[model samples]
Target: MSHPAAELIARSNRLGSDARNTNYAGGNTSAAGTETDPVTGQDVELLWVKGSGGDLGTLRQEGLAVLRLDRMRALVDVYPGVEREDEMVEAFDYCLHGKGGAAPSIDTAMHGLVDAAHVDHLHPDSGIALATAADGAALTRECFGDRVVWVPWRRPGFQLGLDIAEIKQQNPQAIGCVLGGHGITAWGATSAECEENSLMIIRTAEQFIAARTAELEAQGTHPFGPIRDEYAALPEAERRAKAAALAPVIRGLASTDAPQLGHFTDSEVVLDFLAREKLAPLAELGTSCPDHFLRTKVKPLVVDLPADAPVEEVVARLTELHQAYREDYAAYYERHATPDSPALRGADPAIVLVPGVGMFSFGRTKQTARVAGEFYINAINVMRGAEAISTYTPIEESEKFRIEYWALEEAKLQRMPRPKPLATRVALVTGGASGIGKATAERLAAEGACVVVADLDLGKAQAVAEELGGADVAIGVQTDVTSEAQVQEAIAAAALAFGGVDLVVNNAGLSLSKSLLETTVKDWDLQHEVMARGSFLVAREAARVMIAQGLGGDIIYISSKNSVFAGPNNIAYSATKADQAHQVRLLAAELGEHGIRVNGINPDGVVRGSGIFAGGWGAQRAKVYGVDESELGQYYAGRTLLKKEVLPEHVAAAVFALTGPDLVQTTGLHVPVDSGVAAAFLR
Candidate 1:
């Protein structure tokens, strides 16, 4: 019942959904067939190849660029040698069978040259491991015998297409070809045969790795070191803090002139790789294959964690290391670049490794950074597998340079859309698990800020992060604002997860309503600890990271209308909030010199979704006003001029306004979000 092209798309989607075969949109697929032209009523050969930037996992008919096979095949005669990449691209555009308007994959030529009706190409980790190993050709021969051809490395373009065609001519019986330091390609007369052949190659490579791993383990020869018990034994919170402490320093060093977001990974595999004794040498050897050159640099920057050192000392050492890294990278680029190569870009290392801590991946966006981290994690596994059998080998530096500087690859990077207003910025919100804090975090993320949801309840914080789009948009950190250690750790986590802290929302507070005579010393202490003292500790720590980054930032506090208008039996809550109001004024004056803006939002009667209104607090407050619990929301709404009950989202909008460009020049100001409280209006 499906169209012929639909079958090819379904087959492609199946292969792409498995990350072991491809990540994001890293693979390509094509189907060739004969279709009658509506205009001429003559049968014409057509090739449907995956379009540029199209994800195979979500591929549809429209996602494939339909090209005239006869026209594309004629390009081999037009450009016989390594033709200018731009010229070949122009030629491919001229061969479009229809006005699909989607750019074809750069591998279109290679697909056209294969003498088959269906073709599939993928960058499977298992295949890359075998292809990049020192004895890759011999291993290929051993695995598939004469059924597969082995092709040496060449930059992907017209020349690579010719090389593949020549291999096929020489070995007509081969089912597929293993590209050295690249990937695998399989072709057949039908989609089923193509899929089966691709799977066969992948399964064969997986079997080879498994058997090799077993043999090494039996001989007591291990490729990776034992995981660090010290790091593994600590609680998750402590482990996160320890690793986060180095985030800013590494991010600062890894940054180029262009801005980037830095992401940290402390997963089981990342930590184990970091703890390896030979980390520096192993990381410097290069990426597992040339395909990774676009995302991760040829080598990662290796540094010591300096766990016991003071923050200042760590910064100084990391600064020196960063300087040396840039110098070395520029030297390497100079040594290998050709005279006709495009100007160098992205000289900074994409990955940074710290022994006993974790690995940091950098990218233009959080998702890209996370993807780079995932790729490196795969690289670690493949490198281990290759080394378990023999020495881990990677492509030579010259080949790495060619791929990294390839014009077609550079075009992909240039095509990315401009960043959002708050792109690469980080925001940390206290008590971010619910109410105003949660709303503020969500808003910041919607505008492209990486948000840290800090709360006393770890589970609640994590749930909020997951709701806000997981680690790429939000990372939940369990932070007891009353404790100095937890406060410092939370800030460190934000800096490590992103590059640095650019926004801080001091919104973590609790309310206690009791007559002055009935208020216990314990209740008073708790109120001040979470409100006044807590705000001070969080603000100070956030200020430290912001100043270290030397970038101007904004800090907004969620104060209360009761700060100025006193209410009976609300001394504990009102007094603590008043203290925070004055503290904001003082902090504004002090932090302004460092280009940090300090402001406050005084919101009133925000009953809906308010934690203060939950757990019988609203009923208790209504009782004091001689009203039933059912009428509490209306009672508060009627007190305001707008006759509208202030919601948490309304307060979140005010926070955005103060931190956005509209208030770029405004500081030391308090914005009200109470729907017009006449008594609390600023004079």
Candidate 2:
């Protein structure tokens, strides 16, 4: 058996080598991003794209061009057909080059043609193999079916774009298209999805090619002779060290995620392939799939020298290749692009596969890198199988352009709007020292609502405020929401600190474990004073502030699930919480005319390593359940569908959702943040 890591390393090598094969120097893979398309310009607030001559592996924000989205879409309807290509190309060139040295990719027209939020186009061994095969189109169609569309081989450039335009009109949902003798193109609502789709296609194709090749081997003598072992021929130390150096990079790229990373090349099949003079043809076919383009590009890097090449030297060569690749991308943009107005959706490849070294995926965030990495691993296996066949096929350049630039495809590119649901709104949360109150305070902070955390426990409140990250945005105030004087002082302080209050969360409460019959009147009075009466006092002050500010605000009450479902105990706590929930609905009804939104969160056991719960709740609950503290934790964990403890974060998320834009039309709703504890209550 072959180690998957070695196999991945070898296959990745082939993919990178293949990319360099097209223009041995490197290929252009960026977009001209200047000018001002009327449609894309109006639609998007900011469309950042990579600059020409910059490698995606080490790309930065400065390397990108920012553009509006709406302005570009408007051009699609007015501009159609082959003659428009030059105008489009010129438009891209004007904006991209006008900004000085930035260049666009050869595939700029394609990105301009798609409506995808993000797009990726690359030529890989699998794509090329399929493209060059006599039955490549049929094979791709048979394997991918409706998941992808196949285009007859055509020379890259303008006319191919027209063909893709026609095809995309027929299949609106086609993620990408395959060109008979070219590479692949994929698109999605976001870069993550696009990268995933590309890699998925490669994985699917690898399976198909492997199945077919195995059947052929059973029927006749294998075209490629028996496999051999080269890694075994090396010293044990060399093999171990190679595996050690390659694992993290491979793991990062996911070309092959073996248990120990060193297992990739342990397979006999992988060793034989790497030991070959030239990767011998196995059958007649293409590369893995179309999507591997963004990860592996169209080719792999090949080193004819010793296995122990200097790391620095190898890296330098890779760097030069990337630089040349950038130049090629720029030249391509110069020839094929017009106005650099629209944001380039799929011009540059996001990741690069270096044959002997490893794979590198570029992204601004870790998520972006991981998504690209996963695709590269899938591409490696698919490329191996494609090598056994003929060569990989790349999608026609024109078709790739259409998908990359389609308006509908680009619509998916918009990011989820930021969580500033209540812009310029101010909030004050009481009992914000720990648990639900603290959760609610943080939630409002995230929603772009300035918050003041008020609590009797000043230290805890201050700590929570500091963790929220901005002194300008949040503050900790000491006050008893139940005390009229203290409530007034806190409200006054908040007004001075953040101008005026726009939202108030009445979340202070006391929990008593006494049974209903055994409970003292003192317990009842204490609970009501803090939970129910305190809410009324705080709300009164908040309401006065709102009326004075002339901008009505929201009031959210953090109640308890015990208010709805009864246990044998918890009489006083239940009564007060019940009042809090009712108060929110009543307040919402009365405050509607003032433009205020009132809501409540009823949560249970918002456990965390905080002062309140860590004090005794865990221990007491454990004793009640006849289990140790750890066992009690496990009991709660098993009760939820997600099989996780109810953290303060979970409750905070609920509060955020309520205060967020998704609930603009919603008010007076009680969101249960108990991880299905309510469901359990119903059952």
Candidate 3:
């Protein structure tokens, strides 16, 4: 016998994996099957419906809310009507089948009340286009004839489920229904039939939209009206540069309430939409789908500037538009909010659209931001099709406000896990593929910061980035710190990857253990170029972005004990270290006004996992001390006040400390990680 549970899982994955069938975590599926009762030792009818807060594409047995089918249907007896329908969600616990504790979703009532053995509820863009059309009821009749029925909009709850059940009974021949101002729902006697009916409805609607769009093109017309050249996308490189430059400003404004990470996309769909004449007016109407608006906010802030506008001009207008958007959001909350409503969430816009530039979406994490951008793209597709056929109409603003501020939604937000200390921050570490740089990247990533690993070797940097978490939380950039262009590119990469730079680790350097007589001009310049000049370039470029973001940042330098103490046969290296040490103080004094903190770490001998040491410097130092290469760490430790050998992780921990909250107010300072080199103490 075929297992209904296994069949249901396969069907859901098939539909949910495709973006056209449903959005991430936006739909639910259910299977009515027989489960062997744990206590009664008898077969019992059960409904395996998707649990709350789960993506259908990745649904598993643990994410299914198992309930007694008979008990779930019994909820109608005390539903208390649509006004008090939210109460039914709490009542679902009583319907759970023996320890079925996956937390039933609000749609549980819908799956149980329906007479079919299998059902699917999805928010496909094509189906929603017809549903949100002014003539959606007529459109449904035209598309599916009597096969699919049209049901008026009603929020999902016990009442809506009862309504759908009534519709199904009245229209015996109906295979599915077009939900007004929503999406679609389909049901069948088996999982296979139900999956077919769902796909059939989606495909018919898509064909209908495509045919209508073709008709418009035949008549020299467009759903979005004429395309504007001034709003067209710039060349890829130029647009990316613009996005990199403006992301920090938009992110800072978006972070008014809490820090936010950003994602930028200038895809063809986004560019084409921006070039349309209806871009402004249609955008002002806002998204119609609950899932889309929940992530994108009710509406986006449209930057009304030509694609090639000057950065200075764009910034001035963005500042004015951001403040206006906040005021508008505050008013919107006040207009519909009830005394019983949850407190106003942030008034900041989650999505910002710039003509000719692209879209910048903000969220507390990179994944959320990227998803928000995707949801808006879906909304755009829906609007285009709706306009091609009939006038596009969304749910009322008052209704949208109710859903946006629903108490249930507020509770979901409250249940979110606490973020890591550096969760919203982004850090860039130079020479991050090896040694102290790699250790710092790992440490910061562990603390929840998005890391940008920069090194001359792209492969090594990429490997370290992949180990850190790939593009979601970390990325690698091939950067030769000595070059001004590469330094600029690396900073731009950080801005593009994660909103802006919050912390910078200037750890790129080389060592040359040579006395004054042995040191040549070439030796001195190489050390100074990588350590002194390189640190300056990275710091200067990062500070520019930090100031642009207006979010205060940290810049750390990995200097050495030799920077202060007179260590023998280390003239070239010591001179460059001294230059880096002073740059920390100089940059601190200059950049303090912008809230940029600059600090340094002076370590004695980090032998293990030290790139400088492995590059022949360790043996040279060991020779100078008359000790074997393996005993150099011991030699360096015995000379210190405390006989403790320093390692790369020790330097990494110090980097965390200086950037973390404990020393937020301390800057222009150097922390010695040399175990205890009393002679290297700051005066």
Candidate 4:
């Protein structure tokens, strides 16, 4: 009673979950089955393949596009000569088995041509290492012997499908075909057989590379070295500063025709590859396979890292380097493009490599940018594997051009869904380990912004980040906002990990419940130092980075209702809150011309998860109110007209509204998030 398509979905998910097998929607799987047509009351043959832009790991029934096999097979003869990509697409569109289904993958023709019940096509790193080498066909023959078919590079379309079908017919015993400069296709009567064969081929390649790497290492010639050692040797602050300075430069340079989202990586593998003496040549050999053209482009831009230079000087030098890279890309496109090729897109580099710092990947969305980063890391391994065995050889320039400019490939990008409102933007939250800060960070990330959690407790900050999301969308930085140096470093870390600072939530504060006459100078100074001085430093540094990016941003300070309605015996906390509120207005006036909006949130009785309640201030205030500590939260909630307890989430909502598009034109405003505080309402 098991469905054939279910097996394909399960096996596809298994392959997609492993990065060694594929990276971000790069691989696909399909199955053939017979189903009774409800309308026609007749049995029909169908091909269920992964739909366009669907992730196989999370794929479901709806994610598969069902096509009529007979109708699809008929199109093989319709385009007898060089296949017209557009006409072929139209043919597939008309061959859909049902009225409503996901768009079929561009490889639908290739999948239908295989005479098997199950098929899996994947772009594994090990497979790509062999597919792109000059002697790739010979290597394929050696690994799988006669069981594999070797197809020369062809643009992936009708012609490619025809060639594959011809090869299968010529050698009926072959289990799979390794497409030159493309990927591997393994098919069998069952999904298990297909998966086993594919993994076997991949394992064989991995063993070959390991033996070759060991042999090369014995000769004292390494393809890559431990550049992470060099990176780790530098002071942590210096490392962050360099990465921050370099990320914006690379981002600005890569944005030739449009703004790009850049992220820095210093993983051991990435740094090791960057540290090579002849890295420029190795990096310029182009992508390892044709499928990667859309993600990594043809080649990455390599620029020198002036770690000690001022940011302005570094930006100037990088600008010149990027200009040259753009010109070179344009020339490369012109040399290989045919008369009928699609019009060229802009010449922005998708990846940027800095020797002393790290690698940076650029894209329109954070997901795309992260994928580019992943592909580059995989490319390094593929190239290394090739060099260890023989010489590193990539696909020819002309073939790379065909794939990069293919109309079918371009359509994939065009079909991508629109990004979320805060997509590609970065946010920083101080004291984000708990309380309102933690809530704000989570909210921003949910809206599609990369968040940086900065707190004095590094472990707590890191834990909070992990809970919200991993390092991809959220990172943790240990920061003492009271220290200027720490504040600057924290901002740099945010900029380095993400592209730049687009939004900042200044929420780090402390409360002391001593009477004005009994409060010591230390208590007063401590409150002012953290609330007033800390806010000033974080805002100043964040503004610098925002101005440098030439993008307007949002800055929100977590002030308190005490700023307007000071209770007896709370002078230190009340005075500091009032000072910060005034500072917000001043900052708003100064930063408005630069597109920066400064705002403040004043909340009352936010006892849950708040440091003021957790740190015994609530107990002291409860005593003054002649109530137990447990009753203080309810007492304050009841004081508001709404009689609703204002939790940390409520304050976070206010912060989002001010920073989001709804208040794009509003600034220098103090929003109340205290469940309708009557006395503290803004005039």
For model 3, residues 319-355, the per-residue Cα lDDT tens digits are: 9999999999999999999999998889999999998
Writing each residue's lDDT as its tens digit, candidate 1 over 1-683 gives 45557778999999989887766677789888888988799999888889887778889878888899898988877784565755687689889986854688778888888888888888888888777888889988988998888898777777777788788778988888888878888888889999999999988988888898888778875676444443332346755665566676566556655567888887877777776655667788878565576787888877655334455675676677777878888888899887877787867778887655577899878888877887888788778867765577888888788778877777877887877767877899999998999999888888788899999989999999999999888999999999999998788878777867889999998877788998999989999999999999999998887776666789999998988877778889899999999888999999999899999999986777777777566876887788987788788788889988888999999988998767888888998888888998977
Best by lDDT: 3
Best by TM-score: 3
lDDT of each: 0.81, 0.56, 0.91, 0.82
Q: What is the clash count for each candidate, in the order shown?
A: 0, 118, 0, 0
For every candidate structure, what is the RMSD over all alpha carbons to the true structure, in angstroms? 3.8, 22.1, 1.6, 3.7
Better of 3 and 4 by TM-score: 3
Residue range with the least summed lDDT across 10 consecutive positions in model 1: 225-234
Return model 4's CA RMSD, one decimal.
3.7
- Residue 600, candidate 1: C-alpha displacement in angstroms: 1.2
lDDT of 3 at 616: 97
Full-model lDDT, candidate 3: 0.91
TM-score, one value per model: 0.87, 0.39, 0.97, 0.88
Weakest lDDT window of 10 consecutive positions for candidate 4: 225-234
- Ten-residue region with minimum lDDT total, candidate 3: 1-10
